[model samples]
Structure formats: structure tokens, C-alpha cells
Target: MAATVNIRRDVRDSFYRYKMPVLLTKIEGKGNGIKTVFPNMADVARALNRPASYPTKYFGCELGAQATFNDDTERYIVNGAHDQNRMRELLDGFIDRFVLCQSCKNPETELLVSRDGYITADCKACGYHGDIDMRHKLTTFISKNPPKKAGKKGKKGAAGADSIAGQPGQVDGVEDEDNDDDELTRKIREGAEKVMTEEEAARLIAEREKADDWAEEDTSPEAMARRMAALGVSADSSLLAGDGDDDDEAAGPYGEFAAWVSEQKGQDANGLSAAELYKEADARGVTKKPHRLLPVLFPALFDEKVNAELPKYLPVLAKLNTSEKTVKALGGGIEKLVEAYPDTIKAVPKILMTLYQADVMDEDAIRHFATHVSKKYVSKDLSKKVRKAADPILQWLDEADSEEEDEESESE
Candidate 1:
């Protein structure tokens, strides 16, 4: 044995390695010459609702999720929903949310052990599992790529530089905190921008900066922008799916939709307000009336609306631009991610849309949303149904897997 490098704890070949595969293994089930050495299956599945899975699962961020890995083949699989080909691998500290168990959609999970660990995470909802070696992975990554230290700058402690470690690198005076933060923050922001809006990013920076009760307030726009930009986007293009700005026009077949709903008309009540009427238009998914409301306030808006069909009213954003609309509908969506679950919310669009289609108003999704909601978005009472409609419309995805047909059952 040359070095006997423990891959689970020692490798740092690529920044993207181990991330996606670990996540995928959690959901798709393990694949290798070996099988799960642990006995109980059902007992491990129910640990999600509570903090622990005395038998099947374990609790807390300190504790990692459960998963199985095969030694001989070196291939991993999940027991729940996932897309293996699109999975990513990365350096341990690089922040990213790879996949959610189709059952509960919790992305915060970590696989504590890869080979033979006690705890295993299989979402009770739809039955998904993942694999990760927490301690070994973290230690291995940190050891492989030590942080480059820059010259220790004690020039009047700036608020940011205060908490940063003031250690010197092996080379003379070179602990580049500025460069390090910039690099890390850039990666974080880029990752987030792939699935969120500019406005959303700004808001998230502001929120996360303040959410932590112990953290000092950072209200500066430049500071917030830097923070937002720190959370990098993913290298995976699947996360960047859908049309850009130009494609946002004709976002949907809205003309056909408006035509279909044209027959129904509400009375132009004497005392009824324009805002109320416009809201009605939105509810009916009819933009024509709402577009009409714009002409009164801004004559320029009318110009934007000429042939300004449902969503493509150029600058005037409409619900037809599903991406933007999703952000708009989810009040504080972009802004709250920092204070909210930073990684997950930044990449929640696809999973949310999937859940919306599945017709399942998930409790976990709701709790996550509740945690992310800002004071501006929260209300004392139910003023309207914005939250309700925004709650993903529960639906299911139809997926087919390759499996052998049971000839024994057919013999009857």
C-alpha cells in the first residue's frame, strides 16, 4: 500500500467532487458489491419528524444523515428521488445544496458516514437516502488545500477584519482576508444568481446580515452586495434552466389564456377600487384589465403595453414571466435567503415548482418558508391570499425506472 489514503477523509482533487455523488447516493440507494450491513430499515425511516431516529435516523446539524456505500464497485445509490447524471462533486467547504429527498425536500441534511456508520437518512415522506462522510470529508478537504494567509493588517481594526483570524502563512506577511472573502463571496453569489433575481439577491444579503441576533448589523449596500455576491452559483447548468430576459416575453401562451377567460366579466362597481379590480384580473389570470389600470398612473406604461400581450409588456413585468413572478409572488424570496436557509432558498425554484406541480402543500416547505419570511412580508392577519397561492401547488412528478419484470408473479 503506497500511502493508504482514505478517500472519505483525505482527497481534495477537485472542488466539485464528492458533493453530488454523496447527495445522489442518499436518495437513489447504494450500489456496490456490498449490501447495507445494518439490519433495520423501517425503524430508520421515521426519524425525520422528530429530532432523532433512535433506530433509523439521527438529529441536529452536528449529526449527519444516514447512507450506505459499497466498497468493491465504488458506486453509490440513493433510496429516494434524484438525478444522478446531474450530480456535482466539490471541495467540502464550498457551500451548495445538491438535492432534496423527494419525500420531504429537506436540503440541509449531511451524510455523516459513507461506509459503515450507525445513522442513515431516508426521508419518511417519499423515501429517499444520501451518503456522506462528514468528519473525514471536512478534515481531508481542509488539509488538502490550506487557506493562503496574507500579511497581517492591524491598521485600525475595521469591523469585518476584526473577527477574521490574524494568522500568518508559511511565507512572509500574506494573510489575504480581502481576497479570500471576495473569492468565497463571489462563488456564493454566482451560485445564487443562477436561480434568483438581482433584486432577490440584494434582499437576501440584507436579511442574512441582520438575521443572526449576535451578528453586528451591516446595512451598507456595498457590504450587502459583497455578501450577496459571496455565495457562488453552481457549475451545473441544470440549475440555470429556462429562458433569459428576451425569452421572458411571450412567457406563456397568455393571449390564448386571456381569450379563453374573456367571456367572464365582473361589474364595474361604483365604489370599487382600481387596485381591487387589478387584483381580480390577476386572480383570473387575465392581464388585459390590469394593463388598463396602468394607463391612468403612467401614460408611458400604455406605450409598453401596445401589443403588450399578457406577460411581455417589456419593462412592465407580469405573471406570465414565471421566473420573476415566482420571486415577486414569494415576497422577500431573494432578500430573505441570507437570513433564511442561505444555500437552499437560493436554489429552491425547481424543487418548489416540482412540488407545486405535485399538488402537495408540504409541511417542511412551509416551515422553511416561514423561517425565511421577513417582517415586511409577515402580517398580523390574513390580509389576502398571496402566501396561499405562492405555496407550491401540490403535484407529483411521473418518473419511470428500469427494473426487471417479476416472472414469478406472472406465472399465476
Candidate 2:
């Protein structure tokens, strides 16, 4: 394997830095597959009567969302919305950076595997199990250092670069220092400046946050300007306007993540703007941080495709039909899924059998599950057919033993 370059800091600072916390909350919370959950656009539109919040309109967070996970596909499906292409971006960033299982690295999803908090890596080839080192601090340590290959070569080309072991009076007779870019020194200074005592920084940040909140609610430009000045901002302060067009190249990895998300929109699952994603996650009450796909299927789906392509596959998967070429061949019913399910064959598709069976289909569960499908399962092509196939079954199940719940509630 090529020595991986540790862009850990780079990616960490870069990904979704421009995204707001509130918007990101909405993206994760509303989950993904909205179209399937609410086939009627009018119904979906009514639920999404939000005040132009980026997430409510773009990433699918309406008032009354009800999503569920499918046991077979191990993905989420929602009552409205579909944005598989966007979701994958979030997952790829998470898995590539965080999960480190060799089998999961090359996952095989043909067979059954355990996912009940076991540390086994999911094999991408034959579903073989790899060991999980949950107890070890490796994963946690990686958060600080991050799993990376190697650092970029400095100007000296790794040839006796700035090593701390230099002798007191000896010049290492190395590369000329004059040719180095000013950024090198600037970065060093910035790092030192930012590295204040933890307590001091905390107190300062608390005070600043309080000021920021006050500024948000305040309308006077003079007052805002004074607040900005206090925060060490210039009169034409950039951070106040969120840096507008002036890009901070030194923001590191986060520098390119916004552009990446924009370019990746519509092409990846969970495909959302940083603002929209956080908004959805907020409304749905899920993590503004990255998320997991749960149980065995996500780990399986995680393996079946490349990191780049995974974003593309999810939005088109529910329509995925029998492909014996692939071992986990979904039946003919798959393409007919949304239409065939909740009607003809089973009350729920084999895909969703596990959720209700396990009795773990709560709100949060449904939200994540819905996100998975909206991004991965619903296909525009098979959409109507799928609903026609599914709604009746769902209706039957809802009315199963009619008034049973009514009588029970009445007695209570």
C-alpha cells in the first residue's frame, strides 16, 4: 500500500467548515428517503412548510416525518424526500477517516455477520469477520493524530529537515532557509497563538460566544462594529460576514470541503449543502456530528463500492434488481420494491422485516433509516410502481386487527 499522507488536519479543518450547526442538525435528523415515505409531492411540500431554512427545503426536514430501516438492504427509507447522493459524502468521510477494519476496507457482503457492538471488521469480499479493537485507544488517538499515511515533504525533501536533535553550536549545513515561503512561519505563529492554556481559551471562548449571540440579536451596525473590533476584527472584518468571498487557504482541509460538497451535490447520497444538512439533522434531533448506518447492512454497503462512487450508488439502489453477478442478488421484486411492497408479497418487504421484528423502530431509528434509503434506495424510474406495490400492504398492516388498538385505548 502506498504510504497514506496524513491530511487528517487538512480534512478535519476543511470538511463542512462553512456549514452551520443548525442546518447540519436538520440534514441528519430528517434522514434521507422522503419520496418513498410520502409519494405525494403535495403532502411532502405541506410538511416542509419551513421558513426557508436551508435544511427544510434542500435536505428534507418536514414536520411529521416517519422513516424506517430495512433489514435486508440494511438501509433507511423515508416517507418523503430522496437524496442518496448527498448522504454518501458524509459516510465516506466518516468511514475512511474513522473505521479501520481490513475486511471492512475490502468488505464482502454475501453472508450473515454479527453487528451487536462486536469489534469484528466486516469483510467486503466474503463477509469475513475482522477484529475490532474498541478497548484500544487507537481509534480515539487517531482523532487527535488521525489515520494518515505520511506528512508532506518539507522544502528540504525529508533530508535532515528541522529535527529537534541538532547540536547546540553546529549548523546542519542543510537547505537554504531564505527560499521558504512566509506561510511556514505564519503557520507556526498561528499554531502557537491558538495554543493557549486550555482554561484561558475556554473562558475567552465562552465570553466570545456570549458576545456572538448578542450580536446576532442586535441590529445596530455601530454596535456590531464595536463587537467586531473587540474580537480583534478589522473595520472591513471578514469573519463578521463569514469571510464572504475571501477564502482562507490556511483553514486547511476544510478549505476545499465546501466546494467538494457543492460539486458533489445531486451526485452523492445525503447530498446536501453544509447548511442544509445541519438544519435537517437539527429538526430531526440527530447528530450534527457524523453518523453511523447501523447493524450489518451499512457495514456491508460500506464495502460494496469505492469511497468516490458510494455517493453515486445510494440514490439509485431500491430499483436495483436481480443481478446474479452479485451474490446478494435482490429478487425481481426489488425493482418493483416501492410499488410491490406494502401490498402484494409481504406486509413489509423482506428488507424491512427486521426492524419491526426486532421492535427497535423508534423515531431516531426511523430517521436514520429513512436517510439511508432517500439517498440510496428510491429510484425516480420505479418510484410510482414501488408505492403502488407498497402502500396497500402498509395500509393493511396499519388496519391489522382493526380497532384492536382503539378498544385497548378506550379501555384504558
User: Candidate 2: TM-score?
Assistant: 0.18
lDDT tens digits, residues 190-218, model 1? 43454346357765876776587435654
C-alpha TM-score for every candidate:
0.19, 0.18
Name the 10 consecutive residues with the lowest summed lDDT in model 1.
163-172
Off by over 4 Å in 2: 1-348, 363-378, 400-402, 409-412
- Residues 122-218 of candidate 2: C-alpha lDDT, one tens digit per residue: 4332345654444533333223322122233211111112211111100111111231222222333333344434346676987899787975665
Q: Give lDDT per model, in order.
A: 0.26, 0.27
lDDT of 2 at 268: 65
Best by lDDT: 2
